[model samples]
Target chain A: MTTRTTPCAGSEAAETEVILDLDDISLSFGGVQALESISFDIRRHEIRAIIGPNGAGKSSMLNVINGFYHPQKGTITYEGVVVKAMKPYHAATRGIARTFQNIALFKGMSTLDNIMTGRVNHMHAGLLAQALYIGKNRREEIRNREFVETIIDFLEIQAIRNTPVGRLPYGLQKRVELGRALAAEPKLLLLDEPMAGMNLEEKQDMSRFMLDINEQYGTTIALIEHDMAVVMELSSRIVVLDYGRKLADGKPDEIRHNKDVIEAYLGVAN
Target chain B: MFYREAGDFKTTYKADQAIFPIALDRWFVVTVVLVFLVVVPLLASNYMLESILTPVLILSIAAIGLNILTGYAGQLSLGTGGFMATGAYMAYKISTAFPGLNIVFVLIAAGLCAALVGIAFGVPSLRIKGFYLAVTTLAAQFFLLWLFTRVPWFVNNSISGVPTAPPRKVFGFLVSSADSDPIDRYLFVFIITVVLALVAKNLARSRIGRMWMAIRDMDIAAEIIGIRPLTSKLTAFAISSFYCGIAGALWSFAYINTVEPTAFDINRSFEILFMVIIGGLGSILGSFLGAAFIFLFPILLNVMPGWFGLEISVTLVTQVELMVFGGMMIFFLIVEPHGLARLWSIGKEKLRLWPFPH
Candidate 1:
């Protein structure tokens, strides 16, 4: 067990409020417990990292947050609202967006369209308006396209905007996925290994973009990353999980020295 | 070189988002439309207009509809034939009940009626998916045909259970009924199909289209991105059925003159599905191409043996046509699952980069 340390007094992180909190969430599939009694908090305008070994329920936690899986016993408080049961659509509409561990992009569609889909909640034109491509529908489409274009520009993926995402390289696909999550302009962006398959250059680029996203848009990010150095560099606070149980939750430096976390990563001596 | 877009710069998102972004492509479309609307009508024979062109155009509309549902939205529906029956019956009922109504309004009303039925059938998609959902829609196909056949009200209490569309005129030009000219019917069907196809294209490129594709590509991800499965699936169903409905109405009223419930049976459903598949699942142009190929291929098969100076029996030609059709379908599916539209686009892509191997 590692002692949880509070944010240092008079710091910007301490001044921010908690945007999302999970109260003892437990998830299971049949008899196998994927996540058990896990609790964490993500503060506004901060990058919170959840780091653990393989099958430590990191992706499961993201799935629960996005309402893809329902925990048998838990309460989720997002932006001051306590939700008993959240649907994925409801979470998305309430400003929660996420990228998958494996790329879950619309492969048949172009990169621009894939990102534009993130603006689905913002578009409200009726079928008739859409069919005719007049007035409100046309205007709404152009507006969303412009917003998506800005994201493409920001992600430096303008060259592949018209290319189908399935044909894109792995690193670019990950970037497009992040761009899609960003297109929603989410309050809390959940990234599941945003730099999982990237090379050193791509990983550096992704880290910089994540930092810029945190600084520029002030988006509260909760990411599950395995690279200890990048995780330590990017996150303000870290949550260590071992076998679905929280081992430590504190600043990155504290987590690096936590006995339980070290054992969970390298194993205990015989 | 003509297909190049090098100098054509789009300054606005609106320009970039235009259906044909390239100036030359826009002009090519305009030229094709002009030739079809003006030149073909003036030069085409009665047999060409009635037997080949009009039916192809009408079926193209249905293909576009199915493409929207199954191709774009990734909802497998075997209810197209039934929805078409609903449209045919509804058009018959509306035009007869309200003789003073415009022919256009009658077709539109029939489509709306089918849309309502489509929404009802689309409910199962939320709970079930893939082949299971397809089975539910297959039930809709049988039930709708059964409803139209068993209920006398659909056929206006006619003993034969077949309804003939009363002669109707658009802009004082007779376009429906047995006595109407083939050119008028072809032009009418052509105009309606062009409009509907354009609308389908627009919907495909817009937010709704993207929503459908997202759901098709990944429903769980789409849901997390704020798309409600119920709304997206149902909308695809409603719109797809609407196009099929109008196609059905045109099939009975404008082309066939009178249609029985048997006209839109399970075979017709399969036929339309084939058109969507062969045309391209998620492409408006693929729907048109598939429709053209399916409708015209048999006629071509029958004539080709004669043109080659071979004296072939009618029965032999028919048998060979069937085998060839089946073989071609398999060949296309295996060779290019995306259908003719993808091939067409690939050809265009190659043309754009001609004289250089990229």
Candidate 2:
């Protein structure tokens, strides 16, 4: 496991308390290490980016934080409580929501239905209430519908509201995916390759939405992305990973000129 | 222009999310219900009620049950027949055990019993999925069938291995018994189907339905999005079985009027599946359409040969019917895999855009 002693120099500048604290995180699939001794803190209401080339374990780190993968050695402290053996659904209930690298909207369902699913945790109506859809459940549904509609309107997806996500184009699907994640009203939102395979216009749109979400909702974001320009422009702090290890942890300006990061991006000699 | 929603406006989310959102659609449903309740019993012949309309109503209820699981929830279940049998036998036993219980309560109790059994079988689904989960549910079908057939206790130790539905009363009207009026039985089952169907439409439009669709769409994503697959999947199975159980209770008491293990066989499972598929996998209307197609199509074939002044052998007619049914299923599947419901929706869409290019 690679260990780095980077002082908490940036946290003092941001004035935001840590929302997620990963301590001595190490994960390996068989003998191949995915992440090694990585430690970082995502602060409250900050857009944080984990950027690296292929096989740098960016996606792996997001998976660990979301409780999709349990590291061999690590402690994830979420909201000041050390989440012990936390399940994915439990993480979701704790308000940790994420969008996938591949758009994962329910293909057979309308965009409205897909986004409404994000409110599943917020919804408390039981089976009989839902089955009957009367009084309490109906009111709950309409309330949630209003909430989801806000997301839809915010995302400007009214035209495709009734269309199946499967029938949507890739860019619109990505937008809808964000809408779904946003509908959760998550405290911490993770975006895995949110701008992957997008044209220039779509990427700009997504970057704008990401910025607006962070500013408007005060959502703490931890996004894994390959787009360096978007990462540099959008995120307040950047964590750079290389060969399953954290190379640098600082602001975007510090990351851009760090000697180690430069060498990591431009392959180091043996 | 007739189907346009130009003048009608939804003032609130509740009005917008109504089962029939448009005024015309709402009126259409009201008209259909009125015709079914008032006109069908008065105009239809006894033979049509007994051989065609009655079975369509009952089986559509069962198909709706299966559609909730296979279509909406994306859980492929082959244990539908077993669940129905559970309802049938439980209703029979309960009705006999308590002689004075209302028939309505007995049916509800039967559905609850089947729900318990459904939850038990659905436990394996948390681990298994897709066709493998389907195979596991198949075990439920066979196991429950074996239990019902072998256990004479379910049949009340009857010599015939058949558990007959005891006579019962609904709204002070004698139905679910031999010599009961066909129209009375039809009305009872029809009311139940209509009510349940409306309930299903409502459920499908609610948060619970969205969770099922999420799980069906992508379970891993669903879990990440906070849907507990265990609860969602099991709830789907339980509710689906409950609907099937009621349909079974109604089938035995109202339609079939005789209970045998063979009645809820694997063929019945396939038939229900066919109904959901042909009717439209995730649609209430599709369930009725598919059931009508399956039941009434055969009757049509039986009468068509005579209408054409051709005398065909009964066996040959049956053969042709099977071939024609298989061919039609393939045709529908190939033409529009979404089933008759999609076709109906497409027509509605066209109507909405009629007299205009776009």
Candidate 3:
């Protein structure tokens, strides 16, 4: 129901300048390699989807981008600056916000509080002012609350604004997680399986919100999704990973027709 | 009927974010404060003022301190007594060194000393958590108590290793020492407790409070959300110790009127922890409730047997009090893990939905 032009109309524009570039990245845990020689680039203001089967390093790629995990090898470049290492909070302060593959909302906190936490970077009230809660702290809190309320309205989660995220249904939890990330007003939003456990109707609603977020805010999104149909419809470009290696990188139509991608990821018996 | 809020509406965010949202709750608090200021001293006996009321008010401040660290920030600490001792000694030194300084400033300076010590011990919390972090705080408690005992500088090399607190005046009114009325000391501690509690309540509802809660609820998620665990956790330590330090200063200067290394021992730390656990971890009111219950229970236990004309031995009464205290701790842990604060909230929740029963 969100008023927006088709998502693809702007995907073909020549103004697509690269915002993130990962070159020859590798990661391993103990002796097992999680990713090897993976390379990809995400352009500005586009919905980029990463797809793979289970344990194919899709989540790890998202982790590396946000500085949750350090790759043993490879360099990550964002907006022409090379990041030698990533600390999670550092990346968040730099306007890169992300949702986890699992719903990682603070279960003990209410939805409003959870979303309010996303404004931590922007809030600068010191300890003494906060302890008094008289002027700056109070004003900052109200202002952030207003901003978070907009996110709650955007995601259509007004009814459950006070509910503890732990009690919400899986689909609603995912939506709240998205709201939390969007509260950061990020330049690049990373979503790990945003619709992983959603029903068809829930998936449709989530897809619409994602499109609205991208259209209204002009936010650059990179999401990992397993649903081929949802990926094909929502993403401007798709990158396929199989067994810790990149199998294909192209538009959804090209990735759909690529034999190696279909065989490695979709398990097509060709 | 009186608790109903059907017609009440907040016209602004400032009103909505008030410490007490309900009009009735606000009125109730106003009434309590008025009564404490105007009526309490007139009716309370010297024994009640000295033994029960002063200790409750002071320890409640300490419990609030622990709640900020262990409750709000989810950092378990057992160093409350150590920090309290730091405050007591620092206050003693500051008062003796500069006789002209106000006792209030002395207490504040002592609290700062305790905060620095708390931060020093809290550094280990960054690398460890849960039971291990607790052990580190326990180490701080033992180490501080040992330091006060072994080092004569803290006690000013007194021959007895115990010093009677010298008389102190605040605003030209005698508030501490044998000559001061119990009511004077009670009022003095009462005002300080009230002020510090208000500050704690404000802090618990502010952005800093939310950040601590985020770290407590989930540290990894909190980090990704742009909260620095190092800073938030350490601040929780610092603030918690600051409160405990003030409580410690009051313990020696206003309540006990004496300074001794054994005054703040490991037992004191455990006692404060019990108050936090039994009161409610995260609730400011819970800290006061827990302190009152812990402080008054033994006296109640002692008086109950006598009231029934049973003529029970003092030893038997003490044993029964221990049994009852342990039993209540376990019961609270099992039945209401959130402590008495959760129960209070549940009662309020019922009042909010009284006419339309769920």
Candidate 4:
């Protein structure tokens, strides 16, 4: 039962509806088992964190969620629908969006343009309109621009909106990357090490932004973070991954005390 | 006073969505197009029109086609000449075999034929990227040229391996052919180039265009966003090849009056690439600038000899041209990597913000 595990903030009645279901998910590249028969359910609107040392398959889990790498075996059920292997764009259109551990914003484009690209799905003005810059196409463009402007403002990137992301500070680039994901209005937001390289101030700002996004937009968040403190502070439920296997899945407090989780953290494999 | 978007009011999405959202920018383009189409014909001599304008117009079209694949789509191609040749040869075959077919219809068909080939070659892009991908496109260039030269039917078994364009007329007036005036030829090419350029611009701003840029920017992210890489890439190839085909057809029918397989040689491919490179990579206007720069610079270089009445050797001119071209490429890459388009945009921005760069 999820009662003893998968810590959540909402009422018991609403928490049981699954957002993501991993059934005996097994994946490998050549001889290495990147993930092995991992099974779990991510309930709707929960801030879930998958944590482990380097090479614990945290990123692999994120990749598998969006069908970047088809697993060697197992089925992934998202929103009560089973997905054998769906394209990334299909996952995106289905309201799933993710950020990379390494920043992946369009390097040559200004931050505003980079995020605006996320709204391409919503803009339907055909090539003629875009080229001719006539009538309905122009209107759609402005509307998209205004929407992106609001997102830029919301992300507090107004000062650097016109600056190419390649020139931005590392923290700002990460925020812009987050802004890009937010532009898609995803129902499930995946963050890979959102606070990997930030100092205290950046960590605080990003943490606040993550919490605000969850509270205001009611977006579901799943993240992988190496910083135990960040995991402890932000995650309601912590899924511990060790050598591609699930060592523990429980409330943050329970995970802190579990011996198997302790052994994994202490670098003593069991 | 300088680069401001102040008073660019927008009541509807369309008002704000224009490619040139600022009224001033739109007016500038209209004014330039007017000068190029209406005014130039009235003032320019036949010699300038034929020798200068004709080639520039044709190169502009070729540059735009390759820009779609290389610039906007983020795929580098070295096989533009091959696709263009496909168009030329196809046009030749269609014109000769299907005698009495309007040349206009023949031209469109030729471009479509080239587009099919472009899509075939573009498929390899799904697997490779950057320099490696560029080399693969060469296979398309060489293979296509070989097919045309060795295949007797392509040239209608002509001994020259070059097909001669029959003097074609429109309503009893020769628009462009061996006997047509360069002025008449320039006008026809200019008109068609403008229309196709508009289409290219439209395409770059559409969903397909955005998909290409997304693929260029980040393939992993683009795939995740529900865009099929194959579709985007192939579309870019299709569009690019169509333009190249049109340009190729124009080269034979209007400008050259004859084209051998070597006409669409590897040098032709590099020339088109240089046009894109010197022109801003993703900027449509860059194509014109690049074409003008590549085409006009040689003439300007040759000017020194002409003014002094010095009969400079073609070898000397060719050598000097290479040096200047190489230097220009390196200078542009180091100074402004975005190409000529960025330079013009920066100039416009400066003009917009002039005297008030606060």
TM-score of each: 0.97, 0.96, 0.97, 0.90
Q: Which stretches of candidate 2 lie over 4 Å from their true place?
A: A1-13, A268-270, B355-358
True contacts kept of each: 0.92, 0.94, 0.72, 0.56
Q: What is the lDDT of residue B254 in candidate 1?
A: 96
- Chain A of candidate 4: what's the TM-score? 0.93
Clashes of 4: 15
TM-score of 3: 0.97
- Candidate 3 lDDT by residue in tens digits, B95-214: 888888888888899999999999999999999999999999999999998988889888888888877777888877788777888888899899999899989999887878888999
DockQ of each: 0.81, 0.76, 0.78, 0.47
Angstrom error at residue B304, model 4: 1.5
Which clashing pairs does model 1 show? none
Q: lDDT of all the models against the reference?
A: 0.91, 0.88, 0.89, 0.85
Q: Which stretches of candidate 3 lie over 4 Å from their true place?
A: A7-10, A13-15, A268-270, B355-358
Writing each residue's lDDT as its tens digit, candidate 1 over A25-76 gives 9999999999899888888888899999999999999989988899998898
**Local lDDT at A71 for model 1:** 96
Better TM-score candidate (1, 3): 3
Q: Sort by lDDT, best first: what order? A: 1, 3, 2, 4
Candidate 1 reaches a DockQ of 0.81
lDDT of 1 by residue, B64-166 (tens): 9999999999999899999999999999999999998999999999999999999999999999999999999999999999999898988889988786889
Candidate 1: regions farther than 4 A off: A1-11, B355-358
Per-residue lDDT of model 2, residues A150-240, tens digit only: 9998888999998988999999999999999898899999999999999999998888788778767878889899888888877789999
What is the DockQ score of candidate 2, to 2 decimals?
0.76
Residues B217-318 of candidate 4 have per-residue lDDT tens digits of 888887776678888899899989999999998898898888677779999999999999999898789999999999998888878778989998999988
